[model samples]
Structure formats: structure tokens, C-alpha cells
Target: MLEASLKTQMQSYMERISQPIEITANLDSGAKSQELRELLQEIAAMSDRITLVEGSDDAQRKPSFTIARTGTDISVTFAGIPMGHEFTSLVLALLQVGGHPIKLDEAVIEQIRNLDGDYNFETYFSLSCQNCPDVVQALNVMSIINPRIRHVAIDGALYQSEVDERQIMSVPTIYLNGEKFGQGRSSVEEILAQLDSGAGARKAEALNAKEPFDVLIVGGGPAGAAAAVYAARKGIRTGVVAERFGGQVLDTMAIENFISVKETEGPRFAAALEEHVKAYDVDIMNVQRATKLVTGGNLVEVQLESGATLKGKTVILATGARWREINVPGEQEYRNAGVAYCPHCDGPLFKGKRVAVIGGGNSGVEAAIDLAGVVAHVTLIEFGDELRADAVLQRKLRSLPNVDIIVSAQTTEIHGDGKKVNGLSYTDRKSGESRKVELEGVFIQIGLVPNTEWLKDTVSLTRYGEIEVDAKGQTSIPGVFAAGDVTTVPYKQIIIACGDGAKAALGAFDHLIRSSVDMPAEAETATA
Candidate 1:
């Protein structure tokens, strides 16, 4: 008799709890409420997959529940509020609950699963940083690979509670097990090391070991050096990195105009800027490349090509575009000897010597004009019948005394005497004529190719492979930013690239500041 009574009471409770209640927006009334009621009725009748729950005192509050079956296990949860980055997290959570093993090497998994102690990681970041997406994705991937790794993305603007509690002043601030790790940018290897070493306690000493900088520019071109000067004058950390410490500017032969500096050589100008930046104690990393970006909850990660990773709150991507090659024979063998790309860098080296400028576009014509001023003679070769450059440029080229236009001509081979270029072979499309021109140098001004392939899966790109950025240089993915010739912006110039780099850096700073203030109070209040 007792069992029967208990069963009856359970049945009654289920009936009352399962009854669907009406849902109305706070502002909804009369017709709107009726429409919502109809919608709910239709939804309830469509499938038995969901169970409707009614709140105790709110007749207008109804939350739907879905019972999901994976293999032999079943789980239940509310179906609303799953979207955006949260949706990605939800899917991952579901997969984990469904017993789907994370796709990671056994060694990595074992190492992560063995972590039995509590860990707290914080990454600081701003939304305007173009390089942050790479770090964020890497962190998310690591988190998904290890269940014991509880990762949280705190907005520097929205999460004041956590920021205040952690005393975070930068975006991408990461803490492991309630202790502070290094800040700024980092890499996966660096992050793993920090977690394994119990919150980068050793790194704290190393951080103080280095001299304080006002601005540290990673590249030494116009962009990097300019940013360094600006930040240094403004009293910020300043530094720079480049292969030869001058970036692409060192390769140029001459600079006709660069604000106040008139008729200067590329290497000389770049050297001057390098000296200026170095005079202010700006750190420099010549011949270095940033290989990876890593982030924890609030800490940014940067990995170098040499396998070193650094931590910083803000980063500026001044990695300029590389010159595209013609891929003709003997081209690589005599790059600096006879074949060249930047006329402004190599033109003066061929003074009073025969030189050929390939292509018919603006760059090619401009290069031809510049070369005519120094070289004994300039041959402008174009594959098309007519020049593709502006009429003004064509007129200038035609009026030059030492310039010769060779239309319907294509370079077949670059002939060199093993050590340097002696001449080149070409084919005439009009008469099917093959000819060789003795020249001291060949300047290739076809165009430029941006280095954006690394960002393909992370952000949207245009047909030309440039990163698509909005007016403020924000990429499609939040926290990732891009600028300069790599973006869809018009004009690829030194001044423009420098301006873009500054904008990106400032944007990253803004995002970090905003996120620090916008985090949930509960998360902020939680003790380390």
C-alpha cells in the first residue's frame, strides 16, 4: 500500500511539472502573447523530443528540455542560448559528454589528464588585435584536447570583477592555478611549459631580468621603426626585430622622396631609423620571425621561429609582404648579382650600365623611369601590345631619353656568367622573334604578394588573398586584426603601412581595456 501511494504521488508531480506554460516577452501583451502561445503549441505538437517545464509562480515562463542519447548514455539540458562562441563551446561539451575522445596525441592527452591539481588561467586581449584570433584558436584547441583544462575567455571590458580580482591591466592575461604568469603574447609550447611548471613562477624572475622598454618594434622597416619612435616619444615600451635589422628598406637602392629626407638611399634611410630607435633603448630582433601566437585566459603568447616564445599584452604585425618572383631560369642564381625586384633598392648599383625593367604596369614603368636616371640605358619590356599603366606615366616613359619600350615581348631566360647576370633572352609575340639583350641588371616590378596564407582558415579573405578588414581594421573573427598591404585597403606605401600598424596596435589596446570591464560578476568574484 505504501509503494502504490508513492507511485501515485510521483505520477501527479510529473504531470504538474510537465504541463507546458505560456511564454510572453516582458513587453508582450494581448495579441503578442496569443501569437507566442500559438507558436509554442505548434512546437510542442511537432515532436516528443522536448519536455516542457513550467515555473512555479510565473505562468509566462516556460523552458524547454531535450533528452539527448549518445551510445548508451542519456543527458538532458535546456536548448536555448546556444550561439556564437558559446555555441562552439556547447558543441564541444556535448561531444565530450557523448564519449567522443578529443583528437590529440596520446602523449599530450596523458600529460593533460594527469594534471590533478587546480589550475586557473587568464588571457588578456582587446577586440581590435588582428593577431589575437590565432592565439585564441590555439587556446580553444588545447582546451578541447584536455578535459582537465578548464579554459575561460574573459572580456577585458565586460569582466571587471575578474580583472579587479586578478589585478589584470592588459588584454590576454593568463593565470595558472591562481598564480600570475607572464603577460602579453606567448605560444602553445610556452603555455604548456607554464602550466606544467606550476604557473610560470620562474618566468616572473626572468621578466624582471630584462630591461624595461618604451616600445618594442619587431620589424625594422618603415612600419616598425616608425611605431618604435612614436611609442618611445609617448613613453611606452619600444623595440624592433628584423633579419638585418632594417627590414625591406635596407634592400632599396634610392629614395627620391620620404617627407623631409630627399634623394636618400634605402639602406641609409633604414640605418638612420634603426639608429634612432636603438638610441631610445628600443629592443631589436633582427632576422627573427614570429612563428606562433598563443593565449591563455588573459595572457597573450608569441612564439619565435627559433622556438622562443614571449608574453605581451599588445602586439603589432608589421611583417610586410614579400616580392613575387618571375621564376625564370638563372633568376635565383643571380638575385643580387644582376636580377633584382626593387628598383629603388638596386637601381643605383647599375649606374651607367644597361638594365632591363620587366612588366608594363605602373610599377614597371615607374621602375624604368627611375632606372633611366642612373643606368646607361633602360629597356621596358611588356608581354601585352599596349602598356597597362596610366597615360601620364606612359608619357613620362616615352619622353625619357634613355628609355626604350619593347611591347609584345616576354622574357624567356636570364643568362648569367655563374657569378652575375650578363644578359637575358626574350621572345617577340608579334614576329615570333627570339633575341638576347646584353644587360648589367634586370629589375622585376611585376607586383607584390601578401603573406596571408597563414590566416586563411582563421579569417575571411578576398580573391587576392588579402585579409578582409572593416573600416577599423577588424577582421571577420573577433580579436584578430590585420593591416597594411595584407588587408583589402587600397595603396601599398610606406607611410600607409606605418599608419595601419599604429591603428592595429591601438585597436588591440582598446579591445583589452573594454574586455577587462565586461566579465560576469560571479566569475570575477571567484577566488583564485
Candidate 2:
């Protein structure tokens, strides 16, 4: 059931107050059904537009209540009530059935329309999974225009049987036409590309032909986008090669630290980055990852994981970083259930609930502080006897009465109530004593693992595996530059990465000019 404010928003969003489709509610004698009936009744009473029909007691459907468009049989069937994030999915589905535009890209919609075969998508997600909403929304949006496409988002907590049968160990695991499609947080563009091309569980499609560029960016995060934009302004033939544009930024929840803009979410900012890059004449090779970099000769060849090679005079590396994992038992099994990494992304789900922070470093302390404002209490556990965070941060964290710090603590396991995490266990590193803390969530903020393993031996890398970049973002190899979290940057903030990307692009442009390859007179003079 939706809150009053959200219902009002949905009502206003509807184009007209008319019953575009009839709803058949099949109720059972169960208590769950009774509650659902009341909720449905409230929705039906919203306007004369919602016409509801209750099925007979002897209804063939086994579920207590099943709601679907009368004749089409297209439904948002919530056997177990669609609570939490699924509730929003249900509301949006109802709007789409009433002919509300999904507001997707035109080209994507057209591709969906041209789909030759019927597609059934089953998405399994935990209620606490922040990334689940977008994946669920994408398939649901497709089902709106293409009646042949059907989707059902199942809460992993309620359907443990299905979870085991499918071997689902992660949230947002999508099954298309009864076959595994994709997992993790995927973009609408990536999903659309897969759908149109009928790709299986493999990576994105390869380039049709090998192409050359004046400068090639290997990753397409904010840094890559900035680099591309800057290089394109120089009228150079710039191309971006990435598995998916937006990189790790897509995993963040809300970005308050980004300068200038008051606030923005990960997906919105990622989309804006892509849109901004597209505005220039940059060749966007989407859904591709560069596996190998060849910087031996004058021409730099980038071999993609998709088996396509891209040649460029200079290359910019912007492959971003990923969060390190806890690797504890049940940690992977209940990742989205209550074990979350980005506090900004999934913190709100634990509102007024106790949660634990695994690391006592700056990142872990920061996550605890962020969660303290939204959650009821925070327990910060560190293996070291002393916290590794800045003294100022430590003071700020201690000021919060609801926050508790545990020194010399090592997390042993994440305990869940079958579906969702409800507690955690740890060991006292100093005393060798074990303890348990009952909580609804656990946030892991160990450190970031840069996405630079593929660049091994191609260019210089730090002992920490981050690319060794100078002030200008140049790597050890001439004409091969690196930026963002993958570089030896002091901090991994988005704004800092963007500035580094711009600098790397400029450095590449300067290399192009110094080499005297079709360089503009003004550019060569400026470099001199």
C-alpha cells in the first residue's frame, strides 16, 4: 500500500479520471487477503476511474487476491502484498496500464515495439535492495507499450523456494523468458540493447567494425564523460569504450557532495553525464569493456572484451572503482536483504532501525555518520584498537548519542531471518571473545577496489593497483593517460574525478599537438 502523499502524486499524474481497464480482485479467506482487499478498496475509491471486481470464493486462482486488467490478463499480481520498494513498482504499473507514457527514450521504445517474440521477465529482489527499483521499472515500462512483455518482481524474502530453484544469490536477478538475463544494477539502455538484439547471458554486443579516433576513452563514467566532452571541444575524433557508461556512480544513492548542484541521485546524474557527452560529436561505444591496451607503437589499440579493437593516437583511462566486499558467510546471500555497501544508497530503508558499520576507517566512519541521521542507532565495529578516521570526523561521530564505537572487533557473520538480515556476530580481536548485535542492516565501507586489473603490464600501476598518474593524468606510457578513482588521486570524490578527467583530456590534446599531427597553429604555440 502507498502513503497518502504518493497516492496524491499518482492521482495528479494520471491523464484522465477514467477506468481504462477493469480490475478483478480474487480474494481468499486468508488474513493477508483481507488486508489487501482493504488496500485495493481504498485505491478503487480514489476516483471513479478505478473499477474493481472481486472474484468469487471458488475462483480458480490459488492466490488470495489477484488483480489484473479484465480481458488482457496483464496484471501486477502481488500474491504476498507488494510492500516496501515493490509498492512503488505496483503504483507505477497501475499508471502505465492507464496509458501514462513511460517517458523512455524514443529509440528504446521503438526497439521494444519491434520485438518479434513475447518476453516474460521475472525479477527477484529484496525489499532493501536500492538497485532493484530501476531494473523492475525498466521491464515494467517495456510491458506497458509491448503487451507481449510481462514482468513480475518477486520479493526474495517471501519466495525462498523460487530463490533456491533459480540459484539467486544477489538482488535484482532478472530472468527473461524463463532464462537468466542480467544481474546487478543495469541501465535501461543496456537492458534495451540486450532485448532488441536477443543477447543471452553474455556481455553487450561488439562493434560492427573497427574504428579509429584521435583520442579513445576506455571507461565511460563521469570522468570519461568529462574527458570526452573536453576532447570533442578540441574538434578531435573522440570515442568512448565502456561496458556501461556511468561506472560506479550508478551505485551511489544521493550525491550531496557534488559541487554547485544542491543534490542529485546516482541514476539521474549518470544519465545527465551521458546526455552531456552525447551532445558533442563523440562516438559512444556503449556496453563494451576494454580488456587490453596496446601502447607499444605510435597507434594505441584498445582490445575490448567484446572482441572489437579500437585504434587511437592517444588513450584516456577512466575505468572507475568498485566497493570491496565483506566476504563473510551470508554476506553475499543476503546482500540486498540488509547488507548494503553505499550508505547513501540504501540507508533510508533501515529508518529507525539499528545497523552496524564494518570498518572503522574514514569511509566506515562516514557511512556510520550518514546512517545515524536516518536510522535509529549505529554500531561501528573496527578490527584495530583505534579508529583510523580523521580526528575531526572521530569527534563528530562521538558527538552523536545514538552511535556506539567498538574497537578491536572483527565481523564474523551476517545473521538474517531466512530472507532479510536481522543481526550480526563478531569477535573481540583483543579478548578473543565473540558477541552478537541484533540489527536490521549492516553497511560495509572497507575501501574501494579500482577497476584497473585489465591494464596490467600495459602501463605503470601503483603497488596498490591504482594507475600511476602525474598531475596532468599521464600514465607511464606516453599518450596513455589515466584519471578518476583508478588513478593515484588523493581522494575519490566525483568532483575531483571530473576535474582529473578534464585534465587528462587536455593532456591528450597537448600530446596530439606536440606530436605535430594535424595540429592547429594556436594549439602548438600554446603548448610551446
Candidate 3:
């Protein structure tokens, strides 16, 4: 009798389980399961949660959960298996459902809330990147701050189809709506400005107002910023646009070798430089992109992807370079938290934290030596048998007290908690042994790739894609100029880029003065 009663209870429980839950999945089949859809509708009618329709391949299957969006409370689950970096996506999905907005300034929030039109943001990133997380977080915060702003994350690994369609070969490529904005990490202020400008452009279109600025500079790196400052100083109406104002400098670990200053950081150096530029009369289009450029007889016309257009006498290309990624698991998961590329930018953030430097090149050895002074422990992992840097630097690195060099060791995985990095796993090629090291951060010092793709249609690029410029930083084209790492300037150091930028600015001034003297009477009359 007891067995029969137990069987009856089990049967009742099974029946209850068989009944559909409140969650509904909108699959590709163009058919929504009526029962599950009705359940979700019932849940949405309540003030408990917001209804989120997540995209999935299977349309016939019911959604895994009925997400509840009551104030800050929300939950989500994937119908398909979540593995590798997809796990990170799962966590983000939950965060989105929970309505937990990442910390953002109230002023920024207010600015975004005032936006009336649609603002679409699409960002591309690789799964093996460490710095990409900060950028993704910044975009996510922007989306939460304003409903008009929609943030879409494209996985460079899984979305090869979309990548090819969009011509995205690099990580962290941002597109505002359907137009390409910029690439790499961006700040909150920069992104907000871009959205605001887009909103303004749409409003102007509705009212048939004239566009702003005469010339638009696409990058805000040292070279780009210097160009803007110089252009403004020359009394030429100019505007500077960049996805982020600092460019690669913000990702640098240190600036000890930069001229004049004994020591500095990526962010500090960028901040001071940015402030100087901001002091000028120029219109600072921070966190924006010049998507298309059309050269006419007298004026160079530029179309910003934000639906804005500007006319200029000439265009200056100063987009900088980006660091190459060390493809490995867990690197992307704990990037700014523990895994970092620019030691100068994030090294101090890891003060007394255990850190590892990857690669055996000059930058890697140099980073290891520098980090040894600030971090508790420094582990240098090299995939090569011998260090490829200068002998003096190698000797100096070897003599460091807290630095350990492990040759023929390749990083396999980054191990960490969901919130922060903890350690790393590597394999020794020479000994055929797997090893693990406890570390707080990993700095990738492989190399850099120049920002020269946009100039491909305008100037001559080397096989490596760096622009070919003369001694005066003048490109093959007469009015257009190239500077910094984007050019074949032999050296890729900060001082070199600064010197190049200064020379380019002077070159631009010379060109502008010459043009002012040799212009058509009508053009001169207009200026007068």
C-alpha cells in the first residue's frame, strides 16, 4: 500500500513537470509554440519581469526560462549548450535580465535618456582577448543607461559569416547602426558623444539644418590629437573624431621612455594630451567616426556614419595601431580584472598583484623587468628557445629579483574565478610537461598592427599595411598626410610617434599657409 501511494505521488509530480512553463522561445521556424507563448504573455502581463526575446537556431523548441524583469530582478537560461567563452555570454545574459546597470555616471545617464531617436551600436571582439572586456562593459553600460541605444555584441569566432559580410578582420570593431565607427576599446564619454552627435544629426535632418565642421579628423591618438590642435591653432575650422580619444596610448603599460617626461602612464599621458587639445577652439568630436570620405574640386566632403557630413580643405589620417592578441582561453574572461596588455595602463592597478608576461621579444622582457618592481611576482613565459630582444635588455631582465623566465613555454589557458583572474596553465615544449602558475594578471607584449586600412584607398601602404610617408610625414597624396605607427617610420616607440605627429602638424601648417597664398581669388575672398 505504501509503494502504491509513492507511485501515485511520483505520477502526479511527473504530470506537473510535463506542463509547459512560462518561458517562450522564438525560433527560426517562424512559428511560436502557442502554449509557451501564451504562458510568457501571462508572465509579461504581471509587473514581475521584462520579456526578452533571445535569438536561437532552433525555433520549434520552447525557451529555457520565463525571464522576469521586476525592477532589478531578472533571470535567463540558454536552450543550447554553453561552453568556453559562451559561458561569459550566459553570465552577461543573466546580468541583462537582472537589469543591473554597470556603474555609470548619472550625467551620462541623463544625456542618453534625453536622446529620442534610435541609436544602434554593434561591436566586434575576439574570444581570446583580455582588453576587449572593458570595451564590451562600457557599451553594455551605455545600453542600460538609455533604451534608445541598442548594444549588439558580435563574436568574431562564431560569427565568421557576419564578419566576412562586414569586412571585420579585427576585434572590437564598433559600428553605429550600419556604419563602421571605430575599433578597439572605447570610453563612456567617447561613446556618449557619438550617440549625441548621431541624435543631433537626425534632428537636423528633420529641420534641414546645415552640417557642422569644415574638416573632420578620424583618429584622436597622439598624432590625430596633435593634428586637431595644430589645425585649430592655424585658425582653420576643424573637428576631431575618434572612437576613443587616447587611442593605443591608453593601453600602454608605461611611458618611461617618452621624451621630456621621466616617467608616465598611458592614461595619464593621454589625459594631459587630451586636455591640451580640448583647450583649443576646435570642435572635439570624441568617440565618433568618419565612415566615408569624398574629395571634390575645392572641398573634401566627409560623411560620418552617424548621418552627419562635413566639408574640409584637406584630410589628415592619424589613426594609430593596436596590440596583437595572444590567443588563449580565459584571457578574454578576466582581461581588465587581471589579464592586461598595456602594463603602463593596468600595471599600477595590479600593484602587489602576481602577474605574468607573455612573449620573449623586447617588449615582453621589458614588461617583465618593469612589472617586477611593482608586482609581487613576475613570471615571463616565452614560446621561443631564446629571447629575441637586445642582449642588454635580456641580461637586465635575467638579473631582476622577482622575474622568472621560462623558455619554450606556451600559454594554454587562463584560470580564474568569474570575477577576477587567479592563475594560468601552460605547456613546456622542450620538456613536454604541463605547468600551472598562480598569477593575478597576464600582459601580452607580442606586437602591434597599424591602423591603416581606412587609408588603403588614399595612400600607398607597405606589405605590412603601414602607410609610406616621406621624411616630413607627408603621404604620396599631396593634401593628405600620415603619421605615427600608421606610417613606415622604422620605430614603433611612443617618442617616435610624438615626433612624427609634431612633424606632420608642422607639415600641415606649411601646406595650409601655402594654399592660402595660392588659392583662387574667390576662395581667398571667401576666407577674407
Candidate 4:
């Protein structure tokens, strides 16, 4: 299952195992079981400290395996092959179970170990999903930390019966104690917040006690990371507070357009951005969303959703953007239950099933083209008279036999059977006729909406909600700056965002220098 180069890397990684570990395989006479057996054998051969044993047939899922420390109940189970995005999760589980120290913050680790009550978690994931590994790896770490917590990462494709029973139409759907917990990507902090009610309050209290920063960035995408690095290098206190640190970039799949880097994945690129910022003196606060911004005095105040307020001399807004949803009936109800935004992440879940792609831009055309290879058929609906995608992409999409294109069609309502999507309704602009199409999934690929709604009244924003900025990346507000997709910059790309972010940081520094020299002595003293 693993290549020669991958095997060499896995072998080297296994050398960090300082304790004996056992892999108990629960298998039956099945093709997947045999594949799992071979993969387990290959893994076991990489390290002498590891051993593989056959488990009894009493297990609930065949072709599953558990990794556990020799004499400890601390273990995590995998019901399907943990390759693709989950390969990192498998490696982390192996090393963590075999006595390799976890790299999480000490406070987080302690909190997990101290949690009370017994809990069981089952995470349903697809191999192609870019967001599943984080959820799986987080639950795996928690299970290993606290014996009272047990988790199993199940592959949705391998357990189609269970998926149908649960009405799971999305990847990385998590269930706790046999009840639905959440859907989509999740972080360790987010999971803990849901489990422990007091975690948020405690976190807010700690954040409230932090000192004011010279430069505070309100996002963690490429733009935010670049701003943080530039500000931190100026020997000033810099802080980055973000809802997810990686923002929309984490949801992106391929990033071949990023300059200097030939090709990379979103998660990997986000990790590199974090690592680069960490090399500086930037204080990163992850999983924190800013709700409001106040500016008048020397320090600008940013309010968080957690009831915490952060103060800074200068604020850089790089909150980025999110996928624009076609808000219609049943769309929200069937979200992740059949209506998804990411084709690369959730397309595999609809294999051999008919699906539809909304919008006719590059993203939509690309999605339709990609889904044609995996799904039975694809219908591309465009509100415009013609597709806005590049000529090459439109040509490729037209060549796909399983794909159909509809122009001047507006999505009206998504139809679902309470649990999963079955079809959708649309309107023909030219004929003014209503139409319906039967499909198992709907992929929304209509552009993006800037994450600047909170700043609508605070700063000058375009009708579309993007922050308006000058050449120096300065907003209408004197001391406030904005960059990336949140700003008025054209061509919302990663490289452009980085350059804009750097410019914003430099503009803030220039403002600070001029303000200090121009202010009255007494006023400056009072503000300071």
C-alpha cells in the first residue's frame, strides 16, 4: 500500500518509538481485510518494538485494527485503510501510542487527561477529504490521553451500510456516544470547547489578561501570517488572533499557483505558514474569532466572540473570505447531508452517483470536470448566459461526456428527504420556467464572500462587503489597515495576499512613526 520512499520515511519515523506497541487486527474473509493485513504486516516490519496480532471475530467492524500500548487501555481504532490525508493521522497514532511525546501545548494535554466521564467517539471520514485528518488525529490524541475516552476513525466508503443508516452524506462526520456530534473540520480546541462547557470562559479570561500588542492581526491566512512575520521582525510586539489560523486556505486542495513553490496542498502550505511565523516573535492565538473593532485613541480594541477584548496600537485586518453559499430552501438543511461546497473534499463520497455543480465560473466548471471522472453524471448550472471559466477549462469541461451544461439557470431550492439530498429545483431565466433535476449531491462553486461583515459599519466596505484599502493597504480608518481577500485588492490569490499583507504592516509602522512625532507632548503622554 506504501511506496518504497514512503516506507523508508515510515521506518525512520518508527525509530522514535520508545515502548512496545501491539496492533490487533479484527478481520474476516474479505478483500479489505486482506489489504489491511498486508498493510499491518508492512508496518510491523518497520519497527521491532511493534507487533501485529489477529483479533477475535466478535468485533463490530471487520477489516479494522487497534493500536495500543502493550499493557494500557489507551488505544485508537481504524475501521479502514488510513491512507491519503489520514496517513499522517496513522503515523501520529503509532508514534503517540508507542511512547513518543505529543507536540500539543502542555495545558491542552493536561486538560484532556483530566477530563471526567466515559466517552465514545466515532468519526466517519473519506480518504480524499483534506479536512478529515485533523478531526481524526485530534480524537485519536484525546483517546490516548484519557482512558475514559475511546475513539474509532471509520472510513465512510468502506462502511456504506452504516453511512446509509446514519444518513451521512459528508466526510468527517463525528458521532459521540452514538449520537451525532458534529460535521466538517474540527480542531482539538473546538472539540474540547464542546465537551467542556467551562473551557471557553477559562480561555476568554486568559486572553483578557494579555498585554496590548503593537500590531494585532485578525486573521491567519497567508495575508495574516505575512503581516505577523513582517511586524514581528520590526522588534515590536505582534499578535495574530484567528478563528482557525489557516482560514479558507485549509479548505483549499491544490495550490500550484503559489510562487516559488511548484506545487503544494492547502493544509501543508498552511502548516508551513504557521511554522514560518512561529520562527519569529509573533504570539499566535488560534481558534479565536474577532466580532468587532473599536478605534479612536492610541490603542484599537478588538472584541472577540468569547467576550474577550484585545487592544493593539495598530490592527491589520486579513480575515480573508469564505465560499459563497446559494442561500435557498433546503440548502442549509442538507448541508453536508448532500449540499457541499468543496468538490475536492466531498466529491469521492458521491462516487457513481449523479451530482450537480452550481455556478459556471472557473470553480464550478472545474468541479464539474473533476466530478465527471468519479460520479455517474454532472449537471453544471450557470446563472449567467455563458460560462466565465477560462477557455481551456471550458473546453475540457465540454469534452467530458458525462457532464451537461445549463446557461441562465438560477438555483431555487435544494430538495432532500429530511436526511439526504435527492434533487434540486431551478429557474430558467429566458423561459421563466421552473425545473428540477434528480441528483444525490449539489456542489456550490460560486466565488467567495469577504469575511468583513463585522467591519461593515467600522470601515469603508464595498457593496459586496470587502474592505476598501488604498495603495499602501490602508483602510478609510487612519490607523487601521486591511489586506488579502478582505480588502479591495484584485485577483484574490495567495501570492498577492502575502505582498499586500507585508505592505499593510509597513504602512502601520509608518503611521506609528508619524503619529508619535506629531502628537502633542501631553496628549502623547496621556495616550501612552
Largest lDDT belongs to which candidate?
4
Instruction: State the C-alpha lDDT per candidate.
Output: 0.57, 0.78, 0.64, 0.91
Lowest summed lDDT over 10 consecutive residues: which window, candidate 3? 13-22
lDDT per residue for candidate 4 within 1-528, as digits (tens), equals 789999999999999999899999999999999999999999999999999999997999998999999998989999999998999999999999999998889999999988889999999998889999989999999999898999999998899889889988887899999999999899998999999999999999999999988789999999999998887777677899999988888998889998789999999999999999999888899889899999888789999999999998889999999999999999999999899998877887898899999989888999999889999999999999999999999999999999999999999999988889999999999999999999999999999999987886789998989899999989999889999999889999999999999999888777876776243333223211
Sort by lDDT, top down from the best: 4, 2, 3, 1
The candidate that achieves the highest TM-score relative to the unseen native structure: 4
Whole-model lDDT, model 1: 0.57
Tens-digit lDDT string for candidate 3 (415-525)? 987867789999999888999999878888888888766555757889989988898777776666677888899878777776777677667556656774343333233
For residue 284, model 4's alpha carbon misses the true position, in angstroms, by: 1.2
Q: Candidate 4 local accuracy as lDDT?
A: 0.91
Count of steric clashes across candidates, in order: 81, 2, 10, 0
Error of 1 at 101 (Å): 64
Tens digits of per-residue lDDT, candidate 2, 1-528, equal: 658897787667544533365556766777666777777777777656677778777753324343355466555544455666566766776776765567766866887777888888887776655577778777777776677887777666556667666655456778888898887777666787676655422333335354568899989898999999999888778899888888887877679988899998776788899999989889887777778888778789988765667899999999989888878897987886788777755665566789999998988998999889988999999989899999999999999999999999989999997888889999999889999999988899998888888888878888888999898999999999989999999888999999999999999998997785686554344421
Structural similarity to truth (TM-score) of each candidate: 0.49, 0.74, 0.54, 0.96
The residue pairs in collision within model 3 are: 27-59, 49-68, 49-69, 50-69, 124-172, 214-311, 253-343, 253-344, 253-345, 254-344
After superposition on all C-alphas, the RMSD of every candidate to the true structure, in Å, is 27.6, 5.8, 16.2, 3.2
